[model samples]
Target: MSLGDDTGQTRIRLPEGSDGDPYGGARRGGRSSSRSLVTVVGVVVLLIAAIAFANRGGDDSAAEEGAASADSPKAAATAPSGKKPVTTKAAGIPAGFTHDREGAQSAAANYAVVLGSAEMFTKARRDAILRSIIVPDRVADFEAELDKAYTPEFNKNVGLNEDGTTPKDFTFVSRTSPIGTKVTESSADTATVEVWCSGLLGLAGESSTNPVTSSWFTITIQLEWTSGDWKIVTHSQKDGPSPVPGDERASSADEMAKAVQEYGGFTYAR
Candidate 1:
């Protein structure tokens, strides 16, 4: 008698000597058919039990993982820790940051703001800013590099005078606002931090050739802990993680100039 059907349904064929009637088979043949049926049913039941057991095991593991996560401490990277920000100023910029990863990030952010400001285009203010934030041995190097970068031709290109002054009827708009900061590397005495920033530049006036425009960028500042404060060891900048520009209408030059005057920048160490 065949033990299986090709069409997927389980089938049992009675012995060749048995009659077609269900109860007319010989006693021996009936016993043999009953045993075969019982064996097949037992195998199917075992397979079903195994499948159910495996599913339950997976669920238990998932529940255990969820419980462990619930009992663990919350992530600290994105949350504030209630530490006070730096409260001192040098050369009109924030200074005296704590000697920690957070402090490095704060210093990097504030340095980015000042470095991208209109003041940095002028020699005196630029030197003052560099001296305030840069490490002692590196201050002169930074000044020299910036002096070459902010030459008369560069100043005129950004709609400023040859001497880095705003024209009489036009207001030069150069500002940098740091969006966030991250510490990429840190040690007991030195750290490297990246500051993501938004900036405004150009001249704001009705007849100005270069109207104020916004751009996004990131600044990397390597800092050293010195005299209980963070100072810049090296600094560099790169263009953004910028987002798509919005569809909002551009403000008039008068509105832009007035808003800049009314809204003074903040100390970003916090």
Candidate 2:
């Protein structure tokens, strides 16, 4: 008895000296095995062909969708609006945004840039900026708040003179670049937007206490349709969805100063 033999099953023993081929002949046995192999191969080939056909159909669908996307206007969710950016300026800042959600977002983003700029350190420019962007009812309050905030002590702390002037030899670098904007809430006459920003600030000089550094922040702006344009009712800022610092060589003081002088900030953003 073999290890796998079933003791309860019946068995037939062939005559002595008979060929051991189960199909009674070697040729027949070989044929039976070949047929089994062919059947298995046929099934496998059919499965592969079916899979290839399904995948090819899926590819055609995807290609058609991509072509349609290329031919038609981009969906508002995935792309910026096609409306023209504001061409007008008031008080040296971009103004006259369209009366819509996109306009609100654009206004908010540009306002964030100017509000964070070096000009805001000076009282005269800061007041002008506030008057241009803030709603009429809020302008006085905003000016008063910012007046207390950009004090002489604060200016000195950030490497500026008490009067908000750069040192004789050093160049002051304070600029904000809006990364993106989103409207969180909206209506026919009001919108609330968030502007993600990256800012450069500090003094560009070899002997300066504060070297130029980058910071990330988000500004939330509440806006209203006022005087045929969007104006800020209130705005506040919070620190960053910051990314880890990259390993790049730092520029020399002269290089930093020259770059700041040569590279101008944008007038509009969206």
Candidate 3:
């Protein structure tokens, strides 16, 4: 390096090299790399957006399916308000319930539960209860039969009082809960229904002869919709495919009584 005295400018000299491409198009390579990175980021964004859209669509489909199931043929047909009064005469009696097939079925089903209830084994309350549900014409016959069936001997067999009462210091728990309902047949004026039910009938008390027990049964009822509601013309029952026993400790009479008093029964509809 040397300095020029005219303006004190410094200069340097080097060996000569081959001439190559000018304008330094190497900037294009950097730009290309940046473009590739942007493309990758854009693809990732698109993928995330697509996934979100798919999940939202799936949720909507599930909601629609749930709504459809609640309104399906089985539910609709079994519901109580399907038709007008369907009346049928039974056993020389002008006994006909409403043709509200579903309503009739439901009433018959629930009435079966009420009739077979432990309450029906009693005298004073039983007749009143039956009169409320049974065909007005057949109420007397049903009451008479039930009274005869719940005899003193039968009470002893079930460890109850001869007067159709729970023994002193004992708690009786008898209940029926419907598992499901089905209509086997339906016409303009008649329908047959089957109701599957689980029930409990037993004594719960310390030193109680009849400790709490449960039973499973299904009841089938032939119903005719008459007047304004469902009434049973016939009812039948059979044993069940019962569950294995559980090892829960039984409650005392006082506890059972208190629980029953606190709990309420449902006014079941089809």
Which candidate leads the pack in lDDT? Answer: 2
Model 3 clash pairs are 85-99, 86-99, 97-225, 97-226, 98-225, 98-226, 99-225, 104-230
For model 1, the stretches where C-alpha displacement exceeds 4 angstroms are 1-79
Model 2 Cα lDDT, one tens digit per residue, 1-270: 111146743233323346665544534468766765676566668768998887785778778778875436434442665566788999889999989888898899899999899999999889999999999989999999999999999999999999999999999999999887878899999999988899999999989999999999999999999999999999999999899999999999999999999988775545
Count of backbone clashes, every candidate in sequence: 0, 0, 8
The per-prediction CA RMSD against the true structure, in angstroms, equals: 22.0, 21.1, 25.1
Q: How well is each residue in 1-270 modelled by candidate 1, as lDDT tens digits?
A: 334467876655544554676644556658776787897787678768998887785778778668876425334342444667678898888988877877788788788888888889888899999999999999999888888999999999999889999999888999999887777788999999888899999899999999999999999899999888899999888999899999999999999999988999877653
Which pairs, if any, clash in model 2? none
Cα lDDT for residue 247, candidate 2: 98
Question: To one decimal, what is the Cα RMSD in angstroms of model 2 from the true structure?
Answer: 21.1
Error of 3 at 137 (Å): 3.1
State in Å the error of residue 180, model 3: 1.0
RMSD of 3: 25.1
Candidate 3 lDDT tens digits, 36-89: 567656666876899888778577877877788543766455455444432443
The positional error of residue 31 in candidate 1, measured at the CA in angstroms, is 76
Q: What does candidate 2 score on TM?
A: 0.71
